[model samples]
Target: MRSFFDPRQLAHAPSREFHNGGWSAYAEVPARAEAILAAIGGTERPADHGETPIARVHAAAYLDYLKTAPARWLADGREGDVIGYTWPAVRRRPLRLDRIDALAGWYSIDAATPLTADSWTSAYWSVQSGLSALDAVLAGDRAAFALCRPPGHHAGADYCGGYCHLNTAAIVAQAARDGGVARVAILDIDYHHGNGTQDIFWTRGDVFYASIHADPATDYPFYWGHADEAGEGEGAGTTLNLPLAQGTTLAPFRAAQARALDAIAAFGVEIVVVSFGADTWEGDPISAFRLRTPDYAILAGDIAARGLPCVVLMEGGYAVSALGANVASFLDGF
Candidate 1:
């Protein structure tokens, strides 16, 4: 398997995120890949993987902005994290502007995701890590996990949201499709409903998206995960949302995983891209599900046994302190 990444991922380090009705210091801070290397006791260096040219799946200008706009933000006198504009400002402003800083609000879909001085570079590299893992797959590695930071799953084709900027899962799924896989299935096991993934693949039939998540009505993104929102047009019936009520423990989550795997199996997809996120861990600060550490191993084992070549893209898991162990354990099991 391959772990793809670019050095820029280290550039965007968020100080905190909103939770508990206020902001708390970040729990999952991304240490430098060098630190991860040292912690894992790896003498061998990870191979360099190039930055992913996001235009392969997203808009060209958007990709350009994602690569360069953060500099514009920093250049503007405003410093620190670049957050989204509030309601009236964003919804009301429709005019196109050349100022990259102004464009950040337009490009960013929501307030949760912020572009700091280094957001673009770090995010772009995280995407590169994912793409590199895919390239390794193309080279015949049976499985790979891209362990970069700034987890991406909520980003959309033309929009950024939910702490995600580039939509790595979508990019990889499409990469598989473009690489000649007739059908690619993205099984998002992230705690959130993956509203962006659902939206991206909703009108395309070739891609199948099945998600097991916290029910939208009761969870974070409240309008998109209903069982009835099944894909539209050619994508009709291709989207599956198995939203569980809060307080779901490992057993039920495993059953739901089985259901999703079965559906993907039924779809006969040649490739599987898992939008992996361990944020559902029982102790996670912001999530509602009750999965413990070992459960991730079980889920990984199940996915591996499904017998499809896979690329596991990290989505979200903010307990940075324990995140590495949980993620590495799951990958080892997978």
Candidate 2:
């Protein structure tokens, strides 16, 4: 498989992660991309396709905020990284707040993702990595891998959160549609549900979003991701969520994969973009699941058996030591 990445992805180094009622070393770090690249060699740099592709899924104002938020914070005399302190309880119309402090809360969905000076550069490259991989897959490759850092799948059209600034996988999926793909499916096997991806295509039937993750009744991104959130309006019956209980083993995981794959097959999608997250491993700190390292290969093989062209993009996987091996096993099996 051709792996796509940009070395500049390391620039979005976040320092703090809010967990267990206090601040800790951010689990989403630059070493993640480093380890994955080391395990899966021969990574290629992505082409420079500017904000056009990103705007297909994200809002222009949101992109502008990501690009300039750090400078705005610095100008405001903030000494540290820019983080969101609050969010509106009700969904309201845009206020177009120019203040950096208010805009931070306005654009950020949660407190976990902080913006550094180079975050925009890193996130821009992450989007390019996805587009490059998508181009390779559309050009006739069976599959391609995008090692995106500051892992996406969490950010929505108007907000950033969960260590994700831009929804790279969603951008690629939308780009596939723009590139003439009639039907596309996004399969997110992350430990946490891809709430942002679902939000992006919540009302569109052309792109189906399915996720297999820890049940949201007791997991991160505490809202959304329920089995009943089938899709809205024209997109009804297209979105599927297969949430598993804590400490779930491979047997149930594979069973859920079977359902997700069957739905994709039934949808008759031309291609699939997998939000592959290795955090399901037992040792992962932020997630709870009992999947073993070899189980990743088995799970990936199941997806491969569907025989659809795939654009595999990286997502959350915090067990740094075993993350490389797990990711390598999935790609090798695929």
List candidate 1 segments past 4 Å from native: 16-21, 26-28, 32-53, 74-76, 87-95, 98-102
Off by over 4 Å in 2: none
Give lDDT for model 1.
0.75
For the record, the alpha-carbon RMSD of candidate 1 to the native fold, in angstroms, is 3.0
Q: With candidate 1 superimposed using the best TM-score fit, by how many Å does residue 46's alpha carbon deviate from the native?
A: 7.5
Per-residue lDDT of 147-184 in model 1, one digit per residue for the tens? 65677778777677777878888888887777788999
- Name the weakest run of 10 consecutive residues (lDDT summed) in model 2: 87-96
* lDDT of each residue in 219-288, candidate 2, tens digit only: 9898979989999898998899999999999999999999999999999999999999999999998999
Strongest candidate by lDDT = 2
For candidate 2, report its TM-score. Answer: 0.99
lDDT of 2: 0.92
